[model samples]
Target: MPVYHQPRKRIILLIITALALLLIARLSYLQLVEKKYSRLADANAVFKKIIYPGRGLILDRHNRSILGNDILYDLMVTPSAVRNVDTAYLCRILQIDKTEFNSRIADAVRKNGKVRPSVFAGLLPAAVHSRLQEGMYLLQPGFELVPRPVRSYPYRAAANILGYIGEISPGMLKMERYADYQSGDYIGLAGLEKTYERVLMGQRGIQYIVKDNLNRPQGSLENGAYDTAAIAGKNLQLSLDIELQVLGEQLMHNKTGSIVAIDPATGGVLAMVSGPSFDPNLLTGTERTKNISQLLADSSRPFLNRGIQATYQPGSAMKPLTALAALDEGVITPAFGYPCRGGYFSCGRRIGCLHSDAGHADNLRLAMSHSCNAYFLHLYRLMVDSDKWGGVKKGHARWREYMASFGLGHRLGVDIPGEHPGIVADTAALNREYHGAWNSCSELYVGMGQGKVAVTPMQMANAMCIIANRGYYYTPHFVDHIDHADDTLLRRFREKHVVAHVSDTAYHSVVYGMEDVVAHGTGKGARIDGIAVCGKTGTAQNRGRVNGVVTDLKDHSVFVAFAPRDNPRIAIAVIVENAGTGALFAVPIANLMMEKYLRDSIPLAKRPMVERMMK
Candidate 1:
């Protein structure tokens, strides 16, 4: 403050001079030493570039052909960088209305700003692109065409199994893991597509290109030295026999059930057909919306995947497991007997055997061959009635354990999704159901494979496999392996579950009883010459009563069988709903499948019992 205020003007002049000198030095450095950075910064103000990757491909197990891929394309847009564009003419050429064209232009402008560029049209067909190639000057300077890839499926029959692919929605893109994806990126939606998405979706590659002021790609920035090459997706090889699947589907045309065939030794699914299947092509592209709506509207539920999802009362097909359980538990000796006089039993009025009259007692083998309901009722009571077995078993607890051992009370853990763990009622469950009024009568129906017990056809098939394997079975699976360029990738399912908790001697006896079934009993229809076919037949009544009387509503015909009793190969279960008599309906179908597997031919006259039962 001494004379300081008067020196303010001099200080200000000194500051201006220093600033000017600093500015001159900065300009010299930018124009010389940092010229490249300055040039790039200036170039970025006028031009922009985007990188795109080619989508991966999917192939069959053999790596024969492409199942999905991308074709090169020229995507174009309109922006303020261009001087003039005939909006009306361009809209007409691009099959859009003037209003839509204007709206799109406005959106592009907002996205890229008045000085930048954006994309407006994508995936122009080669012919259309050729037409526009000669008229580039007529379009706006900011318009650009970017190459892209789309997903597709071949061999459309495996629609349900292979599933469909679709564009990712905004919500999907917002997910943290999908941050790199845009709204229109394709993703697996179902089936194997959903299952193997990670392996099938290869890493994306990119290329950086330089652009001119007009926003047209001028050339590669570094000759693509930093570019990564797109890798193709791995191929998959399924255990399914396409021919067998096709035949099964054809045979089941117009029906509403599922057919699954597995190799007993390997548990490889040979054929799986859910009736009313639709072509996979229907779910691709523009026609997808309309086709999916039609399929959904159809009452048959073509998309239900019934082969693994639907569970039904396995009916008499469950008897083999029950018999094995009884024998294994030592509750019933091979000498145990029951009589089948006519069509009723000696049990109380409320609970009578399927057969009537009280004839002489028959051995266990004879009872099984005849499917005598009374024999099983006696066995069921022996296992559950603690009073009868001298408290060796608690009420229903031991029986429940035995049944669970047979894999009846739970899911078989097959490879497919949506499998149901069928119903198996115990004392606690019965308490809730009957409110503490549960009795031996409830056990009677269960022994006969009815009332409170439900199972899936897959479970029935697995039971047959267990019996065929002499009390052990591998979990069933549909996929066998995936094929890649360098190696053959394999996925073998091999987990043996022991369903029988009995001695070897008891198991042998039970096997003998099952053999006797086809040798002389209701399952004789399943017999095949030169291939000791052994099986059991059951006809379970549906829910239809008359005046407090129970009559057959529509029988669920079921049969479980295996061939060459000494060295079993294929084991099978067949259920024909609404068909009366397992001997008439399911047995013949089982025999047909066996014949197809063994002799590779359908024996028209082999099943004489079917004809006899029909009469």
Candidate 2:
């Protein structure tokens, strides 16, 4: 061979040697490192089964499980494996028509594709499950029974607060957060379930099943060697008192409104009831989809959680806050008096007073006790038009700021979803609304808990907490502590939220006045046998468009209160929609709830009152 041919031969040798090494490395990686294709290639010979963990339990203050789980069967389907099966017999066992059966199979195929299994008929009834199980072997390869755990409400209370779970949607599949989740996976849809999903969802496990030629599960693949264990979700403990919750629900039966009770010290919600509530069980098992559809179609909107979602005028329930704002601004003292004869005419529009007597508002304490509309209207005017903050615009702006600090005008960041800020018109908004020419008198209705102001039952209840605690409040919450969860998930709830540095004297006057109201004034209905209940009544007017004109619907009966006066424990707000007056319905319900929570049992004498309210 020539010298040039020798050089070419060496180059060819090096190239061949490098090619051999590359092929060896690729084969080693495929055989030992890459596990993607090591599984049985035939879709019928092996199946990947997802083992879902048991979802978290929700307990009450007493550690009693309020929301747990129940086992139900889902008829899972692998669309491609469907062969010669008795479709009509299977549909009969499942209690579905041929069209419905075909529709479900088509849907499963569309959702998860032909190779994967999806829920054909989920959350089967016991009778259906038994019948289907007996015939399951005949329906081999296509459909199989898979156990699924669903939520159960033992007491059947707190439907809106506990929320519901549903299957993951297609849109969610495209998102990175839901990457691990498959089609038809159950997820929390609302309320506390939605709020703590990450902590409560736990971990899902995978198991490979060995299958015969007929696609029947023979046993665990590889003796379960490749199986992963499912970890159960962490439990959650709420501050709720189930007994109190039961009582509130009973009292609110047939009513469309809300009742929110909180621990004054911790801001932990004891009971939050949104009336026209259905049993939480309705959203689980066989009846879920149909019941949800019915609920959604209901005219009253049973899912509208009024505690934080609905907003209304504060009515006379706002007098105490107005008084506090004025006192804090130094525009009024406890001794400041307002002489009223049925109404306040200073605004030249006549903001009417409930009590017509001239002596009804002789002093701040008397005014608060009587809920004299004229007195509070005057105080609101004094704050916004005081010339202390340069102009009424700035003063009004400052007043709104004070209210926001009091947990008004914005979302309180409650654990639940869909909380409305409740319409605290800003200065710019006011300017746009009133065309840059307005004063405290322009919205005197707000001072009397009417007009441009709107508030949620949760905010009102939290405001009661502020007064009960003398100027500070915790952000109202349901879950007190999550079992096995880190403190990082709950630090915000543990921190204190101080509103203003109002003097103790101001708090004393307001508390004493509210006490007097319960003792011998408009809130007399809220009086308990031994507890010093400080309360205020409200008849909040509701308006809506009728045909074309705006007209008044029935006024909402509202009441806000705290128990024992000194060292208060429970701060509560109740609103009964379309009810005539606050004293007629809201007062009795609030006081009854307080009594039940404090005493744990009602006296025989109060039994009649409970019966009447429960009606």
Candidate 3:
């Protein structure tokens, strides 16, 4: 019995020795080879902290405030880490009932895993933050109060232009491109916010801190040497003039159209006011949901940016472009005259003009000044009738190219989003629309900026800029620059684009005719003394008929003008829907805008028309 016991004991001793050696080797490997990993794990247990850099400010052209930062707190919670705390206490501190507290906790857990903190409430006001900061120690172990900057629009306007920020949806979070963004991060949703997100959203930073088992922060591991500091977003300098913008907004109070004014030399947008605009502040804070609902429910669509979004028949505002095209194409000369046979003209068809029965004849200058329909109709026939016009085809294809050169029929590449490219009918499109045949009658309305041609007020303003520039124009821009550390944020759209079909001479001729328009022609109402204001008036007919006949519908009054014929400064486009005639409704408005821009103020009595319209 003693001999057998000795053998078994030796075997058991050897096995125990082998086990000890293996354990020692594993410990040595962990301590030496994986030293960094073990050290990080140890550090994470003692300290955990995060850094948030505030968003940058957005200023006006003069460095005046448009959008600024407001300090707010975001309450976050880790569902699994919350223990022994009364839900009632938490609810009381949060100013919510038990139901809301439970719902919020459940939502947090559902939206994100319990391993990390999820946002429970966001954009809490300073007053609310003050109340919560006192009771923060009573919160859950893994809870956090992150100080963040929320966007604040100080001007309370440019809602469509300044845009708003919203939380990134789960779908966006799922995409690898947005992996850096957490579940509660805010992102730009529209307008300039959406357009220049990269420049506006600064890089996020991280910090390593040690925490105890109770999840309370202990201290920094290496005195913040391992931390990355967030680079603040660049400050944007917009070209908008606060005073001018406010004035324009006031003038458009009761109207339903748009007015866009641009510095012709630099293509900087001075004022872009669309009727039915909303307050930008409404889209920023706690009132967002209610305000959005109100805006959506309103019949007037106050949120729509009519300056860049709404497209309408440009009416006679398009005449200058058309005239330039005709002159450039060599289809018509300045001296070429077309007779207005009373109030109608039949080119083997029954197409009639508004002044046909009045019986007048006009050259290019007189025709444009008077806005004579017969003259343009005659020009349209010659343009489309390539067979009769000596093989010089000035049909839809040529006309479309010329119009495209003026930045029509396409997006103008403006800094703002949601710009309409507008509708332009080519031969194929017209044939498709007419279901097989396109006639000269189809071309008649287009020459007068009716039918298939439509444009946004912004585009119309851009066209006027091109005309004012005498052959070329810089693309309109709202932002002039962005201030950044590495000079990486300064962005300017300074590219010049030439109006293709028209030459400098052609532009000059058109400009001369427009000048005459204000001096002695239909646009005389827009005349500003000592300013050399050149303008064109449009009275576009609507689609609806009054009686059995298509009565001349209440027209959309339009005016496009610039000052100081030799060297233009400000170019503007104004449109008033169902406002009779351009001379009556739009010209006076243009004059007021001109006087305001040039003289820095308008005479009260001279603004009678504007006051009447306001009433």
Worst-scoring 10-residue span by lDDT in model 3: 484-493
| TM-score ranking, high to low | 2, 3, 1
lDDT (tens digit, per residue) of candidate 2 on 1-615: 777799889999999999999999999998999866665354557788988899999999999999998999888999888999899889777767988988988898788778788998888899999998888778876888989989999999999899999988899888999898888789999998998898888899889888887677889988999899999999999999988998899999989999999998998999999988999999998888899999999999999999999998989998898899999999999999988999888877776777897778898999988889889988888998887788888888877887888888899988899999998777898888889888777776777788878999999999999999999998888999999878887789888988878889998999999999999988998888878999999999989899999998999999999998988999999999999789999998998899888888878888889899888
For this target, which candidate reaches the highest TM-score against the unseen true structure? Answer: 2
Candidate scoring better on lDDT of 1 and 3: 3
Best by lDDT: 2
lDDT of 3: 0.77
- The better candidate by TM-score, 2 or 3, is 2
Report, for all candidates in order, the number of backbone clashes.
7, 0, 14
Q: Against the correct fold, how does model 1 do in TM-score?
A: 0.77
TM-score list, all predictions: 0.77, 0.93, 0.88
Where does model 2 exceed 4 Å of error?
A: 1-44, 97-103, 212-218
TM-score of 2: 0.93
Give lDDT: candidate 3, residue 297.
Answer: 96
Identify the runs in model 3 with alpha carbons over 4 angstroms from their true place.
1-48, 84-86, 93-95, 140-144, 348-361, 387-394, 485-492, 544-554, 607-610, 613-615
What TM-score does candidate 3 reach? 0.88
